[model samples]
Target: MLDYSLDISAVERDLALPDLVAEGEELDALVSAEADWTQPTPAQGWTIAHQIAHLAAADANALIAIRTPEAFDTVLKQREAAGPHSADLEADAGAAKPRSVLLEQWREGRTELAAALRDIPLDRPFPWFGSDVTATLTVALRLMETWAHGQDIYDTLGVPHPPTTRLRHVASLGVAGIPLSFYAAQLPIPTVPFRVELTGPEGQTWVWGPEDAEQQVQGPALDFCLRVTQRRPLSDTALQATGADARKWLEIARVFL
Candidate 1:
């Protein structure tokens, strides 16, 4: 029988905070050159500035969610009135700040968020996209966001994103996101076990799901990360799907809740 439940309980709960710090520093270096700010990224119509702005806004929100409920509610209400462009509006406003100011704010914001994530109890629920969620999921979400945006920035700059063990967080998030992915797409849940087997950058095997499951996905970890993030298309990847359900899951798999 297939166990389709998305029990993230199996995933290692560690935030891998050092990995988060390293990726943040890597992105900082990418934008250190002033000219790089205006360069357009893979996100259509979004420049590098927009990419950084989006990240900064996310970090700032993390801090708000962790430290101040009142502030978070205020911002959430504002976004509600602004409608769909709400996020875009925030990003644009963030991008308008002086480059140094924006970068410093991001640095400080993420630094604070990192600290909160480090100390917060795993079971504590914090405000997230639509509901309260645990610190574990929060960090997983942040890892994917940082890595996904970094991929766009790197590709736009004609560079490769160096895959690291940190991707374990992303890979786990991708698997855990299965239920939410279906829910957001308004599709019926496929009660089929799906396995993911990937070779990490160092040739280590990283896997998810039951080995006995009939459906499986196999490939490099980087490819899995890119596909789930939607930064790169499946056609561009080397991943092989061995079952119909796995194929369909790949088509709509997304990290955001």
Candidate 2:
């Protein structure tokens, strides 16, 4: 799935770019197959069109953020001034467009964003919604969003989304997002560290944190990814937690900001 060795200890653009392309291409195929874009997805209030629109808009925003930090700040200001539901508004606006037009925009934006990420310097931080991040985290976020949103489309279409090693990126991001998940849910971050051991698609083991940590999470990699992305309910996954903090983290896990 990756050109070099898969070292998700830090997700560089090389690893994320191909995975991003794979995820986008998969969703693109599903949406392109349907003549009707008005079909509703599992995401409440979001249609199939809404899903693609959101990805397109997000990719466009990421492109600007990577290429020109100053320009991205203006975009951020506009989103802020638009208020809390601004993201929904952006999706709504794009969803209003013709399906063919929206598809073209999505493809173009994705291509451009991937290209920009390939050359971006990893040292500089750029403005995101309320924070700044470098290209490394930026590309990983793009991949995670693409895969997570693609899941909604897949479910709506009754198509199976086979797990791939590309998910290593999403899994890593999900694990790293433990703190953010707690913060988002208004829960205090746990002081104790967690050991996460997931069985990958090919039956390989992917582990994070101290192996001897008392609080632990063990499960299939796909299940962990689905849980953290909130695509699948915790009750439905094969994941197991050994302590209070580990269990609570699964309840509110989220990979996106």
Each candidate: what lDDT?
0.80, 0.85
Clashes of 2: 0
Best by TM-score: 2
Query: Candidate 2 on 1-257: residue-level lDDT in tens?
Result: 11111234356577677888888888888889999889898888889899999999999998888787789878978988999888889989999999999999999999998888887776777777767776777777788888888999889888899999888888888888887888888888888888999999999999888988988999999999999999999999999999999999999998765
The weakest ten consecutive residues by lDDT in model 1 span: 1-10
- Best model per lDDT: 2
lDDT by residue (84-153, candidate 1, tens digit) is: 8877888889888887888888888888888898888877777766777666667667777998998888
Q: What residue pairs are clashing in model 2?
A: none
List candidate 1 segments past 4 Å from native: 1-15
In model 2, the Cα lDDT at residue 128 comes to 79
Query: What's model 2's TM-score?
Result: 0.94
Off by over 4 Å in 2: 1-9
